[model samples]
Target: MKPGRPAAGSSHWLFTEDRLREEVTESQPALLPLDAWHRARGGRMVPFAGYEMPVQYEGIMAEHLWTRESAGLFDVSHMGQLVFSGDGADAELEKLLPGDVRALKAGRMRYSLLLNEAGGILDDLMITRLPEGHPFGEAGADDLYMVVNGAVKFDDIGTLREHVADRITINHMEDRALLALQGPKAVDALARLVPGVADLVFMRAGAFDWQGVPLWISRSGYTGEDGFEISLPGDAATVFTDALLEQPEVKPIGLGARDSLRLEAGLPLYGHDLDPEITPVTADLGFALSKRRREERGFAGADHILAERENGAVARRVGLIIDGRQPVREGADVLDGEGSMVGRVTSGGVAPSVGKPIAMAYVPVAMAAPGTAITVSQRGKVHHATVAAMPFVPHRYVRAGA
Candidate 1:
């Protein structure tokens, strides 16, 4: 499936099935900093998340397999890069997020969510605490770095400005570009440029410089592979990308392969697998809710979120393995035992890594256990599917000290 066809949340290009394409086509899409560079490399550019992004440079199947075996570089610059500074930034952010923001030590990255008053997810994001010496922040100032979905970044910024205390200054770093170098051989390719990055493990981030350009590098990615997400100035995007592509093991990957890779990894896409109607508990993302935050209960919709956690949500997000060779896309209706609709498939595709058609859906708790059989109706055709454990493909992250 084309990445543009799905509901894109920007930074993640969150997936949907059909409406996203229609939404992007209705407006003029902006160009990325690597726009001309992508075109020069034979990238098939498409309108996605209000920007012209490369869907593929080569075929999706080829890129998917290559990344699983070697290394793939993705232009994720369309995602929002936000910096929170001034006094009490961390504590102020904690009020809107369920994660224990105040306890996030410097140079560590945490996966978190921007939630609404009702515990509905506004957007999922990554937050990093930049230490005192990080070039992105003042020499002695610790700053909180956030990367939000590009599709809703402006809205996210507005929400932050409105919700957080005025003392916390939120700077939208629009001049920055983000890149992900993923796969088994990713570390090797990146270490050649910034040797210090080799020391960082999963969920950690640090600042480094290459030929005078400052980079905020993190040992993280969404593809269930050992990878790094690098943030740099937009002006340096073409040069840095070219440098990575020069490595023998690295290849330019498109959003199509990215969508498939994340699907196989069992990571939820914002607009599809997550939305305002879905809380972190129902989406099976309780990990983002820290223990301290749960007890303190200061975040938005804490009452509902905590209650749902204790009593269980009405619906659960579960993985599904569709029967047969034909794959189902998003918006497929999940059916109960008696043929009545019980839920809906949020994300579905042929998982290249798993070599099967896998999907994610919100189903009643009774239908969420693994091995439970469920029926699906797509385009009036009936298809059988079974609940399966997620990350259809095993993850290869380089854990701490590994």
Candidate 2:
């Protein structure tokens, strides 16, 4: 919708010489197999996450709704996957993050954050221990797999390297392609192509061969569905994605739909919903802090985090379900009963699945409770809204033993 940006559904942008030059030369350090896939599929290539990627294929809205009803394959190869190895790896990582990395089972994963000394979030990440016989080898050798936001990959890598340089080995898996297959029908669709994929529960990961290519598969995603994120060699990513799209239930989704889907799920987008200015407590991500890690007080800004945990944060993130059909977009100001600004919308949109406008924002703790009345100001118009429970669409994660 922005000017100069390629219009939705037009693949003409993919043939621009600048795009080709960037993909072949400028983005060498972060290229993935999906790059070629996008070209072949008429993807409108653009610079994202330090790589040239498809912003949309068929269309954003159509791709978005299709993923909700069926399945959408997202090329998230731009995400940074770093391996940390050495003695006391878990303890070292815990010192930087407020999560109990040591408590994670070998095949399990945990959502966590990297924090600054002042309690600001540096980045949110998913940490998974390498499963037995995987490429990283057993845990004792001081190895851990970390996936971080692609937009901040360079900064994240630099910060990690600066702190743990002498103590561990950090391998950036930029050569790999990360594919997210998400939707209500994701599991069934993937099961037909990759046998045994459906058996894995949420947050569990394992190494498996897909069409003879070794891949790291995890039953996890950002779309609030029972899906999987697969990491494979970059060279084979296009081949693998093509195979997935051939399935009747799977299609390609773009960034616009990705944003809407996650918003419907009440999930936070790093730069928007979370940033260096926002603390994890105020962001409603306090659950990510483990009990042991909280008690140990070893991570950055532990003093502030613990204090907030005990006394409650002054501001808290909450969901807003608007009464009107018109969507309230990001940056909308939230007003209290007195028409005073209480907070600002971080992520907001018309949820296709819910058929209503929904938003997520951080309001003063006193006004964050469910059913609280609020107003959203968008382009000089006031929209009545109510604070609602998160995940406007209930999550379909397949928990262990579920």
Q: Against the true structure, whose TM-score is highest?
A: 1
lDDT of 1 at 100: 84
What tens-digit string does per-residue lDDT give for candidate 1 at 7-105?
223222223323335356455898889999999999888777889888888788889899999999999988999999888888889888999888889
Model 2 Cα lDDT, one tens digit per residue, 215-329? 8899999988878999888788877888888889998886667777888888898876888878889999989989988877889899988898899998888999988777666
- Please identify model 1 stretches exceeding 4 Å from their true place: 1-22, 25-27, 137-140
TM-score of each: 0.94, 0.89
Assess each prediction's global lDDT (C-alpha) against the native.
Answer: 0.86, 0.79
What's the residue-level lDDT of 364 in candidate 1? Answer: 93
| RMSD of each candidate relative to the true structure | 3.7, 5.1
lDDT of 2 at 15: 22
How does candidate 2 score on lDDT? 0.79
